[model samples]
Target: MGDLANAKNGLNIFLNPLYYGKINDNLKKQIVKVETTKDSAYFERIENEITDELNKRLSGVLEDYAEIKGHVSSFQSLHGTISLNKASSLDMVHGKWATHDDYIADWLSGLKDSIESGRPSMMQKIFKIQRIREYVLLFLERDFYRHYKVRTKDKPQENLWSIWFGSETLFWGLLISPRLIEDNWENKPGRIRKVEFGYWTIGHVLKTGLVDPENNTIYKFRDLNDFLIFYESILKRVSNSIYEKQIFAFYVDYIRKSQNPLLEPLLIPEFRYEGIKQKHKYRLDFTILNCHTGERIGFELSPQSTHMAISGIKSKTQTELNKDLALKWGREMQKRNEYFQQYGITIMTFTDDNLIDMKNCFKAMEYYLSKRKADRQSVDELIQDIISIK
Candidate 1:
């Protein structure tokens, strides 16, 4: 079953229209330009361009796209029905259709008569009406469902593109993170703790929830309308953070200006590295791919408090201190180095200092690239020397 699933995913990758063209360089440049300018218009323009490209490439598969879209539409319609059912209840007396007390009494009397006669009751009729209303609202008001209904409209195509790309496209991967920190209200000190929400595929937006730490409860959005409201709020807050935004900008700038095709860079934020023997994954800050060699190079931006142990910050417990130390220079570091070396990749470490001075970040990358080239030369010389000796 696992193999079958993998096979299906692999087939889907080939079927993806974006895979037919090389988009890495163009996308890198566009992202860099938009990020630098902080202009919303450029973001929309890029999204439209991507949408047009996808539509053009997938023209041959329109029938398939439509078929899949039909399935999605049906599912969303049913979901909207369920959501309405959960959110609304039948109050026959005070219902929208019959608000007057006398009218409601008559309706109930008629409903009771119908129930006795084995006919569909007024209660059933009211429920169907409410269900239809909810479906209409969901279809019209919810962005995701509306996208499918009106793809050619002047709305932003990012979400539509995400659906088509199976949520694994570079655009989505770079902009979002799996883990986020929220204040733990249960703790008296109101410590800000990290929560791993796992991989947030495009579909996740439909049903994402937040935890109420104080009550040990999970609060879910009532519907798509509710979800979008919360999602936009959180997006503005998290995406505006200085560290992530700066890292993203620097990464894009580096890739755009760097001429070395051998060291093709990809910005993978919150990358997950699976452990060899342990059933766990370690999340790194960023990862870049060397396109020519298919080698992965990792970069980690360590904050001063966690890595440098700068004074005057709230003192950490022993376990927290130990974990931080391991991440910085102890067993965790050793394992990461060993793992990367085994695969002939390099992991570069950085601090807040490098982030502040982006020139230092570029220099570090250049140094690594040059070192790799030099190492190749040394290996070639050694091979020639061995051949001469023989």
Candidate 2:
């Protein structure tokens, strides 16, 4: 984690995407395009200046979170990995006569054998477990396995958490899940979940935020900060219950606020953005027009993107529900039609279904809208006749 501090700014992306929607490629390009206008010298100077300041800020924040001073970080990529020490003998389980290492490897192998046997009974048991979390090769003794954990910078909690052995690992350009995200924050929740394309075993640490001065050398998924990093692709224990609920709540709030005509036409989203604040006057990833108030506000489309602003993660950063947000701006209203295409926005997300895009939403409440329009039309006609007489 070269810049674990780079995380402090956007670590909650797995939680709230409004935070990450800005730093995306499209937005970065837009920011570069907007700021670089005819002044390469000024732009480069600013970049250098920002980089210097960022180093300071990131270092400070990461330290505050739990990173020990003078500890060298082995995790480098944006999907940062912290290489830690692994000792087999010390990981013994009392009475069980099994070391943590042995137990883990055994578990992995048993799981593999179970899957490989093609037994229906095992599959049924696995179906239940799969619902809970994806099987990322249970380690039976020493045989190590690998998985691709996708997420922004905060935490590679979970997105496309799968083991890659063959050709899939070759191209490894961060394969985004070919699924509707955003309104679904199952794996990608709260930032800093690393996507490991290796035989990486995550270190489990206490949440007391205290770092062991002696074990500072272990850095791959190491626990320096109170923020826990897991190399396992899926966040099995807590994802469905906590992550999904929290992000979905945020999306629900967004929809609720959008529905309130206090603004005008609802600001429909074209895409999501991560870190737009640093670049624009208003940082937004989604665009929506309010039909009544006629205020087309820029929305930051995040299933639950929060406010850290760093960028550069391979897998976790690929399946952008926000599309970098640069694509949503400046389009004409007619574009909203896009072939009637059930025009709507995802107001909510979860582990399974993307809930309540505007199109479906409007259909559900169609009667109310129709009646409101009718009432307005009658009033307009009455006024027009009165004016005509005058």
Candidate 3:
């Protein structure tokens, strides 16, 4: 009976569009040997691990979510779902998080209080932990339903991305932390938090929640939307961005001209069109404000914070030039940022007016400012600095 079942399953796997021509026969032969040894020992190893992870993470019971890994022989998607595990078994249903409304309500209250009080207690950390864990578990279950397999009640299609996936799960959760600080009732604090501002596609982990002192915060396992926003911020131009690379290039020239005319500026005009890395020539449309670097200072620009972008038009008549320039400046910042990273600085985005606004952009600038001051680094160091403000 087991042999017959394997024969039938193997036949279907070979015929499946996702696996058929995409993978060669050699890999397929190896996969069969591994997932279906006569003793089934190899297969059980992954199954037990995945099941245990699901059991530990999931709050409620559902076979669909519980036994997802066992049901699928293997999965794959190239719709550009880049992950460390993409080339292997394509089980990504373990991503995303779920949330409950009442929990969120309490979380919001606590989070607001913590922010205002200027102290994040253990209780607050727990709130951050619970909310973040719950949200991640929920997202994984939701993905199981949407992409993995149909519910027993079986609708032909999914209803709403928001229905299954809470759009404001973390957005509001960050609003409601365990802290008792007072803050504005209406703001979505997720956007202002430190991790949300990263320019790299470190992955979905950073995308889901406000990382606190508890449960580690990094993009390696962040949600899709969070990754998207970070990616969008880095790659896409918000407004008034122009040859962001060239602008930065010219800025460097301007600095040299004023301070060290003997020190010639970097002449990477090829990057203005060819891209800084030369592979993905995606341009940004923003201004790259070289963090008022002084030659005496070793690393002046906190490439993370000092980089500014003009999102809204300066005068906003909705003219082409205004929109185009907004985009152009965004590019300059991203491009110059390539050069800036070598010095261990990050690029922060600010609109032209906001850069001058002093009130709004001051703190954003200080994130990298402090990083430049510290001996330790990486995006993690800037997290608290950026989160403490908004």
Best by TM-score: 1
Which 10-residue window of candidate 3 scores lowest in summed lDDT? 156-165
TM agreement with the true structure for every prediction: 0.29, 0.15, 0.16
Error of 3 at 34 (Å): 22
Residue-level lDDT tens digits of model 2 in 140-199 = 111111111221012211321211111111111111121224432122333233321111
**Could you give me the TM-score of model 3 versus the true structure?**
0.16
Q: Report how far off residue 366 is in candidate 3 (Å).
A: 2.6
The true-versus-predicted C-alpha distance at residue 384 of model 3, in Å, is: 27
lDDT of each: 0.38, 0.26, 0.29
lDDT of 3 by residue, 303-388 (tens): 32334334454555667656676676677666556535433323344445553444344344333222311222222222232223
- The residue-by-residue lDDT of candidate 1 on 222-315, one tens digit each, is 7544644443443323443466556555544454465642233334454544311123345455554432233456666666655556342367
In candidate 1, where is summed lDDT lowest over 10 consecutive residues? Answer: 160-169
